[model samples]
Target: MDNYLTKTSETERPEFKIPDFIENMGPEQIHERMMASLPEDIDKMPGGFPFDYTMPTAAIASELVHYHLVRGLMAAFPEYAWGDWLDLHAKQAHLSRKPANKAAGSLTFIGKPGTVIPKGSMFCTAATAAGSSIDFLTDEEVVIEEEGRATAAITAFEAGKKGNVSQGTIVLAVRPISGLTSVTNLEAVTGGAEEETDDALYRRIQMEHSMQSFSYIGNDNDYIRWAKEVPGVGDCIVMPAWNGPGTVKLVLVDQNGEPANEKIIQDVYSHIVSEEDRSKRLLPTACSQLTVTAAAGLSISYICTGLIYDKDTTTLEQAAAEFERAVQQVYSEARESGTLIYNKVRSLITDLPGIVDFETFLINGEEKNIVLSKEEYPVTETVSFR
Candidate 1:
């Protein structure tokens, strides 16, 4: 608990140390305690007959001391626990590790006419450096037109962070071939997500209670809470009666507040509608129509100005970066679509050090509140400081 910011345990104490008196304790000390509680002449036919190796009591005491030492040590750290504690937590919340997903995008192959590029043709981002290039395989065999460009679907050889590349990033071929010279990625290769991390698992375990389903009133909070139970659903909104009676609309964003991909949307939709899906712990009431979709994305461009102090190590650039990060973290926590209060942003600026006066604070070029619809969340685009 000392270093709470990152849950660090640098100066933690060792739990398994033997007590000083017990570690140095000898047979003589054990005999003394026994003698004090016993009769003076209970068994004194021979020399030290009551407290000898023949009695076996000394050996029993040693065993008990060892038990205490081992138990204390095990209590010191979570790793010492026989099983993975976090794994247990994940099981309770049904939070399983998601496998790495390959980012899917379009690949363009430009070559001579009628060139038959076989299916599973290899291409990468670079020529010489194989690792530097993100490899892709043609999804289907495409025959090129006469001296024209043909696009193919290239699946990454392996799935991981390597495939989460930017748009137009992978342009080079892994090895050159006749009639296949240039290659380009037409769109961003998104949907590539790494395996679920321990931190992510632990966070969800902490929310098991809040995410528990109620008696299926199917109200706004019920829909939102249950919708987020699906993996990769970062945040969600519930619009009750959006399409008149017995209809509800749900909008979801990915864990990073981006639009949910096709796969994610389908997963959410199945969980909400189907009775046999993994997350369909309890099906919704009959006769209620449900619509699951991705929320509209919007960015909040703002300018923050503050006075500079002479001794401050932080520059305006650094402060602006910090302010922008704050907006993303704070605003996304709730993500309730509606009016974004201008005063909340101004209050955030007031707390920053050396900002004696907030000269100009604007959200999307407005000094006052900026209202957003039910399907929008604020994106952290730019934060400028003067």
Candidate 2:
């Protein structure tokens, strides 16, 4: 097997390149080769019967080579394989793609005191412009407090990111409780994530293969892998013995590269250490303690002066929004790098559709790159243009 974990140089690594033989195989080339191999007396002209008959054969042969040879090669490597082929690699590595997770949060119910809200009570968000709403179901029974309000834990009716609703969005009850007055979420409901993608599964498989030689007795890489096994976890930093010997601390972020919320933090902890059962934990038996927390969000503000754009084609607000999106794209991809390049951000802004040029561009009120610590991830706080 190719050692993908090894680097040829400090900054360079090997990548798979298609061989010339495979690259040059096409229907036209195959057909010409077939004609040349035949006797000269045979009719191989474009309008001849021999040409027409051989052309179809060549096309079919080319397709077989592409499917059986080209696709087979791709399926053999975790880096290039996708779909079911990727799953096969994952199985060999003892890894499985994380499935989509349902959003979970508390819902506040207001009504007459002592009103019983039954388990499986349903609530929904307001219908969107398309006349659709996400539904949530109560996880257990609860009663209204003396203050005519109570909070109940709830889970989304469906599994996926669509269940992640903002605060105050769940306003309607599917069936009105006799004494219930209103319902809403006090905090943003989060932790919902889509099914893991091919790229994510590939990374885990690569990590699995790379760490095969390393001891899995609660090492930094082991903790990183354990945290990532949770569905909503994106990436994490593991600090072994940060507090003291036999103690490990983990800082995590969600799939969007944002600081994880409490739900995700709890999920990772449960997966790694399992507070209720020490024996159920993934950690080494000798590891004394583990602590899991969310990464601190470091907000980076942008200030641009003398902004120029095509006013006739788009407004300043539109251009700024586009630039903000571009910044987010770069930030998401660079989260693991631990530094945000100032020039790269400026270049993205300059390359926007209506943007012409900016006399000054600053990140977090400076012209220098923003460096983050292991427990920090950058978030776009604000964008201002003059």
The candidate scoring highest on lDDT is 2
Quick one: how many clashes does candidate 2 have? 0
- Alpha-carbon local distance difference test for all models: 0.63, 0.81
Cα TM-score per model: 0.60, 0.81
Q: How close is candidate 1 to the true structure, as a TM-score?
A: 0.60
Per-prediction tally of clashes: 4, 0
Task: Name the candidate that leads on TM-score.
Answer: 2
lDDT of 1 at 263: 57
Q: How would you encode candidate 2's per-residue C-alpha lDDT over 138-167 as one tens digit per residue?
A: 989999999999999898999888888889
Which 10 residues in a row give candidate 1 its minimum summed lDDT?
1-10
Candidate 2 lDDT score at position 138:
95
